[model samples]
Target: MLENEFVTFSQNFLDRSGNHRSNQKKINEYLCKNSAQYLIYWRGKVPVVSDVRDQLCWVGRDHPLVLNYSGMPTFLGLENDIPFFSINISSWLPGNYNEAAAGAFFDSNIYNHPDLPESSFFAELRGFMNRISAREAELAVMTRGINVWQENNLYCSKCGNLTEIINAGWQRNCVNCGAFHFPRTDPVVIMLVTHGNNILLGRSHGWPDKMYSCLAGFMEPGESIEAAVQREVLEETSILVKNVRYLTSQPWPFPSSLMIGCVAEALSKKVLIDPKEIENALWVSREEMLEAFSGNNERIYPARVGSIAHFMIKKWLSGSIE
Candidate 1:
């Protein structure tokens, strides 16, 4: 489907991106034309969504601090064809803008910015991404990933000291030690394990009722993706898997995770569910899956539409994943 076409965010794209079409000359020319760049900010875990939660509100576009693009500020990468840049408001805007002085950034749920409109708040980035270039959306996701990584990794693992932003927010430098830290994306393996007429699906706690998805687990240190898939399925559902094959990957930015999609052959038919990892596990037949996809089956519900779990399962049912 068209929903999954531009969904795959590859590592090669991120590794080679950043200022792809912008040179000093082009950047300056664009800035001189009164076209401004904005940095969309999120507080705590909640993205600053609009009242309707439809679009992400932009700062410095026509706000209290009208930022000029010609003058340099920190870039947060281009998201949806719009260049995002963060300015040290204290350094750029001249006024009494300091509300809380506890290092300018905090990680808590506070009730401020009450007057801002939803249009100036959080955005369903996926929906807005359709209007922009692929590379721009990818960059925006990366910036958000970097922000999440920085928030979680404030305290260093090597030394119990706070880290400072360096490399233009790409890397962090620890003041206590000379260690440099980079962003981290945890790798998880999500597979549609199948044999003959059935495919394995499991549901975790806190999920919607009757909903199931491909089994997934983090790839542990020094473990391969194939081994991780087999191990996860076997551990959670007690189903032995063989001939595991890699299919595709998705950049799941719900706090920064890279999902590795796969298809594994089920070596055993019996299922022994691990209550700790799953609320329930089942092997549904092709006919049942078709019903689920068509929304006619009351026994099971497919995974959320935008997720790779849904994509993998749909592909499997259509005989396209074999």
Candidate 2:
């Protein structure tokens, strides 16, 4: 995939992450010196925008800010001279000065209001991702994922005991059963399954009408990425896929997920739509896909740019998926 070259923290959580000690010290110096770092806080899937940091403060959701990193400050070890971890706050920018300020900061539905700078935060971030050093974006993604995972997994799954942040917020220790839990990355298979010159795609019920992308689903307990691709295709659209091949992946931190993109050859073209999982499914031909990409196809739309689905499909159109 052409987008494979983008910098991502695929190895950030690996065993050798300890090598980042020196790097953390440096990043910490920068963050602490600044008035406040750009923080991404979420209320469910919607992110709360801090329109003005001048009047903003973070109150820990329950407890005061701690260095544990589990609730938000779990030290993410170190990265050179920078120390990066997560931070959690109950709410953000409590008193609103202007409703227009909301959309100017973050483009979220809950925080969306008119009168603010009219710029979508996600769009701005996407522009930054496309231009800035990939390392910066990678760091931002990693930081958000770490913070979200720690905030949600506060208790032990087995014994229902409260878990404490450990290993610099990378691991959680169960007080009752001595269980150590690590940050989790749920694997999702996103595949562009093709038959001849047509690619199979589907959309869920709540998605915008005619907005279809690659078929995707969570990996089963013991399923491999390739199996997930085939299984998801069959289950959702009854399209049997063969010759599955890996392409690339992206860390989607909307609650911590790793989207694994792949390309698969379709063995059967029959579409037995599974209404429970998808609102619609179809096989769009190469010409039609090109038209969709160019915004000329009115019946279907391509996946949003910057997404793994878009990356994979673009690769195919460029003859790189081979």
Candidate 3:
């Protein structure tokens, strides 16, 4: 019973004008408009105004960064007649930047651009996902996901030839094989399994200590969502599950993944951890989970906010998920 709007990146506030993506003339017209604005990205990080509320920083087409940028801007969509676009300025690097820190699991370093406002700095989406509005979160995730896909998939998989951007950054055409490729979104299932009064949680290897969340696994080809949920739970914790029901979903664009949230009834409670799959597995009662969520439990850390796991766990704690 989790509400859709509360989920980050789940809002549909912008109009994704798909029909106009292939229209070069229309795209050019929109680009030239005064109301058009562009979101800037560098090395997978987005620029945001560092304030009490982290707002997405948008610059005009005539800005120094945009003018100096070398590639075509990807048309995101229209927000109330105002066209929005995204462009990667990854080629521009800040002085004394640490590549390792920027690529860390939780990067807190902020990179400021000399040409942009002093209040604006580049930040990771996961760091401030819960601080921004749902609309801005959606936009930022969309821009980041698309840019990452474009960067990593520049070459054609069909023939190993270079591909050119098309359909306003939504599609790529292979120059040699004439094949079309679209952005790839891998589906993953994160489920909450329950038996009697306890819920299942597991922590993967290399995760921060004491941090545990719902068991999750990537869905393989030719597999149903429910089947994936059951198989993953069984494989990781040796727990048999039944009555697999979907609750919600979140667009986890850490590298383009759609998290399918589900609730399953556990037939057994004994946990046998699979070392290759996860570091540890445990069952926590409802009271212990509530304590963990409130930060009162010292031995357990709940899922991070702005994630579907956290949302589903909260719903289950409130007796909303059957």
Quick one: best lDDT, which candidate?
Answer: 3
TM-score of each: 0.74, 0.74, 0.98
Clashing pairs in 3: none
Best by TM-score: 3
> Taking the tens digit of each residue's C-alpha lDDT, what string does model 1 give over 125-218?
5434444445555555655666667667778779979987754456677889979888788999999899899998999986768988889999
Which ten contiguous residues of candidate 3 have the minimum total lDDT? Answer: 45-54
Per-candidate Cα lDDT values, in order, are 0.65, 0.64, 0.91
Off by over 4 Å in 3: 51-53
Candidate 3 lDDT, tens digit per residue, 87-145? 98888877868889876777778888999899988887888899988889988999999
In candidate 2, what residue range of length 10 has the lowest lDDT sum? 52-61
Model 2 residue 2 CA deviation in Å: 6.8
* Model with the higher TM-score, candidate 1 or 2: 1
Candidate 2: where is the Cα deviation over 4 Å? Answer: 1-3, 7-16, 19-72, 77-80, 93-133
Query: Relative to the unseen true structure, what is the C-alpha lDDT of residue 87 in candidate 3, on a scale of 0 to 100?
Result: 92
Instruction: Name the regions of candidate 1 deviating beyond 4 angstroms.
Output: 1-36, 44-62, 65-74, 78-82, 86-120, 123-140
Task: Give the TM-score comparing model 2 with the true structure, all chains together.
Answer: 0.74
Deviation in Å, model 2, residue 153 alpha carbon: 1.0
